[model samples]
Target: MDTSPYLQSRQRLVPAPPRAVFELLADPAMHPVIDGSGTVRAARGGSPDRLRLGAEFGMDMRLGVPYRISNTVVEFEDGRTIAWRHFSGHRWRYELEPVDGGTLVRETWDASRLKHKWALRVLGFTRTTPGNMERTLERLAAQFDGGATPS
Candidate 1:
């Protein structure tokens, strides 16, 4: 986990190969299945089927109010890491490391570049993000343990 002042991260050892996990991450349509925030409702039209660097995808989100967010893939390293940033300028990143039993997946929420950092911090997202990341990893791991990724 990153201990830096600007990022919150969580790591989990998932019993799935990096390639398999990467495939799921690269597909924007599968995001709602692994999202821990519970805000992602669906992938909207015009989103990419498989995301690559610079690809843009739109997600229907609901957090008391229904809305959509368009995110751009900011980083991609085939089977290793992927990150995206939305209009808010914060980044959501995932890193995968091959381990003995499976893969060590680290998910990060970076708000260092957020325009309204004080506002978000006041909202207590800083305290909530790590737990959400842990749940996200668990859900991703469950997808490999005799369970199907929700469609």
Candidate 2:
């Protein structure tokens, strides 16, 4: 059994360059299309088209009921890494590395600084989040399939 508090998906090799993949990830409007968790509905109006370090954006979300949340890009490194955090304090991070074939992507759900870590544990986020991250990576990879590299 995994004992780490943070949830991370296994690295996936996407058939696209790091810049291409990073372009997709930096666009808030494309999030719903590539989201594997099915929670992201749309980008809220007035949200930035592209995210940069410290940029804030909102998303329409639904788990059981519809709601909205704002996230701030907490970490960004051009075409290599990006991470964001919401009010809940946990962070969602994506790290990209250029490999021989394509870009190696790893998604992580970080709860180390969460205010209510036990609450999330009780809510079973630990058990389910890794799978969600995996699906998210799958969807991300599919976006680059068939040599459709986005600029």
Candidate 3:
């Protein structure tokens, strides 16, 4: 487990209604839809279908090759908040809030105490790092703004 503090990103999007934004962010099945990054390979069994608190799912991504992680919903409130923690070791969280035009989404990642050390070394190569997370965030914001890029 990494003890270091996690990094976070808070973004606001306009256009997508609370219901639409909530559905897109809350459900795991929509991963590929808004996640233009091509990350989140597959869910635990297969499809996400729907999401609820305490629910667990599998995710795969390609930094350079491929990496997989399991995640579970830690907390959820309809059209309010949804928090998830990484189950595969790393500590991560995602929080969503309803806004005037759409919804505000925040994502965080923590890998402070990586004993592997090797993983830290690899992260040093920022050039080859994955942009899936960023791309997904942008897409969500755009989709929320009725497919318009927010300023």
Models 1 onward score TM values of: 0.92, 0.92, 0.68
Given candidate 3, what's the lDDT at residue 49? 67
lDDT of 2 by residue, 1-151 (tens): 2358655456799989999999999999989977877899999999999999999999999999999999999999999999999888888889999999899998888887776789888887887888777778888888878533222
State residue 82's C-alpha deviation in candidate 2, in Å.
Answer: 0.5
68-117: candidate 1 lDDT, tens digit per residue? 99899999999999999988898999999999988999888999977678
Give candidate 2 regions above 4 Å deviation.
7-9, 147-151
- Cα distance off (Å), candidate 3, residue 7: 2.0
Candidate 3 Cα errors over 4 Å, as ranges: 1-5, 44-48, 112-118, 124-133, 146-151
Q: In model 3, how large is the Cα lDDT of residue 110?
A: 45
Candidate 3 per-residue lDDT, tens place, 5-108, comes to 33334354536666676777677766656664465565556635677787787776665688877778777787666666765355445566667755666655
lDDT values for all models? 0.88, 0.87, 0.59
Task: Looking at model 1, report the run of 10 residues with the lowest lDDT sum.
Answer: 142-151
Itemize residue pairs with steric clashes in candidate 1.
none
Ranking by TM-score: 1, 2, 3
Error of 2 at 90 (Å): 0.5
